[model samples]
Target chain A: MSESLVSRIKPVLGLDNKWWWDQAAEGVLAIQRCQGCQSLRHPPRPMCDQCQSQEWDFISASGKGTVCSFTVLHHPKFPGYDYPLIIVLVELAEGTRITSQLTGCEPDEVDFDMPVEMVMQRDADGFQLPYFRPSQ
Target chain B: MTINVSGEAAIAGVANTEFSKNSGVSELELASVAVRDAIADAGLKPSDVDGMTTFTLDNTDEIEIARAVGIGDLTFYSRVPHGGGAATGLVHQAVMAVATGMAEVVVCYRALNGRSGHRYSSGVAGPLLTSDAIHWGWYTPYGLMTPASWVAMYTQRYMHLAENVQDAMFEIAHVQRQYAAKNPAAFFYQRPFDRADYDASRPIVSPFKMLDCCMETDGGSAVVVTTAERAKDLKHPAVIVKGVAQAAAADMESMTSFYRPEIARIPSMDIAAKMAYEQSGLCADDIDAAVIYDAFTPIVLWQLESWGFCDLLEAPKFVLDGALRSDGRLPTNTHGGQLSEAYIHGVNGVVEATRLVRGQSVNQPAKEVNNVLVTSGVGVPTGGALLGRSD
Candidate 1:
């Protein structure tokens, strides 16, 4: 199949590309911080879940955390995605947990509590996808 | 306000479409078929139903369902969010409506073309970058993208906490598959899994094999609820809605409740279990059977522990000892859970609980079941309810 055909079949959201590219240019990993609790959250919401407060501020994180958990995907659900991609749940120092893919090492090398840091990788659409790597 | 425990509600009717990897039907059609079957099973007409409930993720609107089924008027209708946790919560809403005389007869339904339609296993995109996605974006940029990948984080931590915990997660998958093997209506019926099969299965996330995950199926299920009095007059015996409860804890978020003090604990489900136990006036020991929402295998372990069936860190031992088997102390998911039967957003679990109480389940327990406990989705703000055999 041609590239445009695949793009038509699996449309990529414009909002995601803009946000990811913005972070990559700045070389900073940011999360939406709920104004009410001053806590970081994922899947950015219009309102704070803790206090139902809608106000949010972009906050840069230390980008340092331990691997709370991980999975080695042997079956890629989508085409072009290779086998054995390390998907991880990272417990950030800011006291929140988030899910992402782990890169920079072999799948077997990834373990629980292994200190990891973030790295941006470009997708087929030139959108930067955040993947993790061992800090050491 | 005191709920009348003696005056219970029953599941007078049950119905569902065939479970399969592909169902050549729209979600609306699937839902209608299940609803029609349920009405017929109750020996009643669609016009008789006055109340309805379903999950938040379901695409079929209540008004659409009401119109499609040709029901004249609706007195009560509700939609519960939070994935699989809405399973028994649907019953909770229906029972309250019936018990309060808000609606005489209520039907709860869930329909999905999960496999042939939208597959949840697909990777995350920017639209998912909502507040939840923003949080995951921080991590996804690093690598966690799917539900199994997200849950794998907690499961690994749980295993790290307990050394004796063998592949107990496999025990849960194996049991559900075993029950499904005997259930002709199950998606995995006639195909049983063993420890070796589980081990050989590809890993989705660490500690979770492909076999550990629930299969995506295209199907629909509906249950009819009516007052004990009305149910007694219907075509089947009344399976009383003994108790119902929905709960969410502080710092609770979808799939990622790790910010709380104890990442391993499910405080929301704990609260729901306690409320159900107290309201029903029945202990865990009184539950003759249960239909725990098993969207993922590790959740079953957490639910069993949180419900006080066993202490923390002992869920593996509980399952390995055959405690959750059909003939075991607590027969669970007798119709095959989301793991083996189908994942209609946990509504099928309500159907199984009703069948157990009605003595119509394919994997009926050895003992006479008086109390059946059914739970909704896990890893999010969830719901649960207890169904009893009316006297």
Candidate 2:
């Protein structure tokens, strides 16, 4: 209600997950892989769950994913944001899932197992965020 | 060896301030009133309380509340994390404290002017502390702000997997609201069920209508816990703590834990239920009534399966079949739940559980309720409890 759907709000970054924002800033969707367990995790943590290993690395994702789930949020709208926001949980081709927004698509356009592709977009504040659109 | 807390401790008394959209009071005032009333309900003086437990999110302080209630010495105190999921965990904490002889009388309370004060419906708007923002940092920037959105992601995945679920979401709302319609304490009291209303309701999050969400109200709820031996000498019938457990499963995030193998399943609920049932020595069949968390409608479905009330992914039909009705197998949240009743988080559910076990519920079911299962919220580190009736 205050302004356009795009707000200048940015994610608060810390020492551990700053690298994730760095990847997005460069227009690359990246995921964290546990160097010890050979498995992947996200949001950039220090330890691994499978083997309790504190070792990890970042790998560039394929930018391909499926619509694992989604929602059309309307009420309690935020400043500089439109109503009925389309938020999606995408299961990346790398077997891990990530949370992002959907652009260039309608609400009814979303479906279960819908295929999507990740795209990095910059906000007015120059903060890069990962988003998904219908994969061509 | 660990002690079996079942029957070791009991809830001697329970009390709740009026559920309202605006309490016109401070959270500390709410806490003070609820705790003091609960102590009096137990036929005990405020001086008898030596221990206290509450949610870490609660604004009231232990020392402040102790001072407000005019208590003597403070031996045991704890603050459970995970928002609404800390409901039953409070009882678990108090039971442990009293059972271990660390404290004589422990009072657990959750006080919030959620409507007039900090409303959860707005979601996490601005940044708080760095340490507390772990979960939000991952999802907040991407239009995932509200608790409804966090849950919507899971509900989407779950509905996709279940496939058979359609009207169950609305029906879950219907049944719970049906229960609320009968209870004067509920916000939706006397509001009859109308499927058309549910269908016409505006969508807040996909697969979740406005009715699918829990009401946000300002109120306080509290319970007094003591050793079963001492509780028997007090006021009302003692509701013994049979089994209680808390859990945070593998790959646990706060709520937006979509990175797991499948976002559809709630491992937290499964783990908590397994542990609680093991502690209570009761299976799904043993539970006569339930107060499962209903922060959202799909959560009830997810929990029904995770808690072993039905087969995996079969809660849709199970719930649609009126399994939650009083005449059905399990009369759940007969006090209307958070959806219809005031959202005092989950403590109100436990109060309703105590009523059922005591055979004093207004919407009392036909069956003999020997045991009641009460759960806190899922999607975060959560907990559950099984309460039993005494002769």
Candidate 3:
């Protein structure tokens, strides 16, 4: 999508979260995996809740998940986005659930338990975000 | 340690600004007016008020309200965090303050121009620098930026498990509107809606038509809390604070705590339900009236189940069985709630609960109202209070 056509909702790049955005811009979906217990966490936090270990690093996600739930938002339209936006909560193969937009699919076509894979789409804000689409 | 603060404090007065889409006044002015009215209703002067409390998101500060209301306070001012979830928590804090002699007269208020200025429905946009905002950043990039979107994640999963839940949700909205129609103070006064209207309404997030979402209202509400002993000499009947509690489950997020064992069950409220009953020595069956927060319609049913009003999967039928009617087994949100009344966060529900205990509600239930269950926000770390008449 062209920059002019996209609506750029910028990410908040804090000291703890800037890395996650950097990884997404590189077309990779990465999440925090506690080195102490290997328990994966999303919405990356500073320390591992499972082990309370401050020492942790990111792991590349499998890019595959199933739709645990989904919703189509129609009101309060945002810029650079289509009406009737589809948002999905996916249970990733790596045992963590993530929230991402489902693109390249009709609202009626999306359902619970549907398989999807991650794809990178840059928003008008000049930053890339991970989006999911139906997988064969 | 049980730490029973039950009946130690009581709500002596309640007041509210007229519900409107635009109040044409500053939030501080709204706070001042409501606080003054509440204090006078309690038969107390401004000098009698020594403490104040409100939510952090509320734009008006305690000192600002004190100055505007001509209150000269020296001790006890606090702010509770979280959004609508902090409603009953405000009472909890006041009860603690009054019970412990930290302050004699504590007033809790929430005043906001939610619809006219800084509408929450417009969705949040900020520096995104706070810890909570940072958490929201993960999903906002994907177009999940609004509160409705956050709650829709759980609603969709709930429907998957309870196939016929939509019928119950539609009925809940319709019935609440019916109650709202009777409430002269309600935003939807004289305008009752039915199932067909719910279906015809525009979609907000899936599973939530326009009626499913509460109106963003510009209003303010205030309550007065003092020791039970002091309340005995006040103008109106004292509504004893039987139980006050704030609870958060493990790994609780503000709104999007979706990784629970059951995506549908509100764990924080479950914890709150247990705590409130334990503190008050009252059971779910003891409640004659309830004011469950209705920021969204689906949460009301979720609360009914979490609070043990019915089985987890039986909430749909429980509500469909006329459970919310004025003559039903448990009348709920008789003031129409945020959906039809007004959204001053959930503090308005607290005021309604007080009115129920005082037998002063516009839509008072037919049964002799003794105990009332009031809840804060749901779909997040939540709180609840059980209020009863101080016979």
Candidate 4:
């Protein structure tokens, strides 16, 4: 096994990197609103996958989604990693789905379709990995 | 009510690039080389091919492959999705094209420099950046960043239900590596593994060990599909495609299918096995040999149980008794399989199936192989087929 790296320097990117990144930076979630099917999308792409149309615009989101599924990791795959991390598949209010880590709670506390919102956290790598918290 | 028939779709030709960790060739180049070799193997020219089928995940598209391989035109060309599940499904699509007269000669191929170019073993970087990535982002902070980690959860549950039948899974790996050790083309050829090796291997997940996982490789393999009538006049004996089927169960995801009624049992495989048996008119007793997908060792055990080769909980016992060995009741993964051989998205399994029916396999079966069962991936939406000797 290789020696694990410690005290890693994390690089942070500005919201200008991508539209979705910008939305994350502003604390207001945004998804691509398809002109073809009028469906909303996340992690913004160039075109609508459903209709394959190039006409898409940014739409502000409710920052609310339901947990479609989840898995609790009892083992840390990497060094400086903590165990019992909860991961959930969040289906956004617009019906667009995304995967994020559930935070602010323990593993058994999470359930399917449980409402959640994105919460960013700095990992051991110094990068802000998106974590989710149960919605009030 | 469906009528079932048993026959064969002759394998007109076979070709594959040398297996290696680094091919130093573009995926398109690799695919073209294999296709050309397959065309020549059939004693036919490139223009003879009228159809093509491959995996949707493949970088090389069907039209691009046709153009690169110097084919004039194509009447049928398509791609199957669901990763490794499309392995045998590609051949099935080609057989259908030829059988239905949509095309005379069809080629099915998979070419990937998976090791040198793109490593799927790396953390799930691609999916994390897309909306799909965002969806997965919900999980990654929880530390589920790799496919192995996702599969590990289900494997643990399976082991628990089987009352800690870890030996059954290890036994399947033992048999596969054993065959691979004898076959010169296998990566582990001349390097046989035993139960101790499996036991000593490091754990990837709770139940899956390093040895249980398949290797990542770079190579391309191609199979030519033509009518049984045409195969009779070809260069090699016709290894007909007897039956083929693909299925996706409810609540299916890429690797995270925890929403299913039973995570231990792959309902998709059950659906696929039934369809394949019905189409081929052959049950487990009729199969002379098999080349089951072994992406993970536990999947092999589950597949055996689901296919009715043994009782659900009796898988470990069945494997311990050497039922899956080359000299056993039903020889499996005679080409070493993904575990010991190369993982060309399960396409190599199809190549071995063809060899078994032709009586020309490096790890040939003990008895005459009248019928052979070949399955594609097990997890997610999967596919399978039964290949046989054309009378």
What TM-score quantifies how close candidate 1 is to the native fold? 0.72
- Best candidate, lDDT-wise? 3
- Enumerate residue pairs that collide in model 3: A7-A80, A8-A125
| DockQ of predicted model 3 | 0.01
Least accurate 10 contiguous residues by lDDT in model 1 chain B: B125-134
What digit string (tens of lDDT, one per residue) describes model 1 on residues B1-391?
3655434677899888798888865677678778878877998888888999998889888776666556768999998887777888888888888888899889999998899888877757546634565666656776777888777778878887854454677777888888999999998889997888788999788877898788898999999988889888889888887778889988976787777776776889999888888877888888888899888888888888878888988888888889889889898988889899998888888888888988889999878998888888888888788888876
Would you list the C-alpha lDDT of every candidate in the order shown?
0.79, 0.85, 0.86, 0.78
At residue B387, what lDDT does model 1 achieve? 88
C-alpha lDDT of candidate 1 relative to the true structure: 0.79
Q: How good is the docking of model 2, as DockQ?
A: 0.01
Summarize candidate 4's per-residue lDDT along B1-391 as a digit string, tens digits.
2533235467888877778898765676678778877888888777888999899889877766665556757999888987898988898788777777898899999999888887877767554444467557756888887777877778888877786468777887888888888888787888987778788999887777899889888888898998888889989888877778889888887778887778987788888888888887779898888888888887887788778798776677777788888788888898889998888989888888888888888878768889888898877688788888776
* Rank ordering of all candidates by TM-score, starting from the highest: 3, 2, 1, 4
What is the iRMSD of the candidate numbered 1? 15.9
DockQ of each: 0.01, 0.01, 0.01, 0.01
Candidate 3: stretches off by over 4 Å: A1-136, B125-129
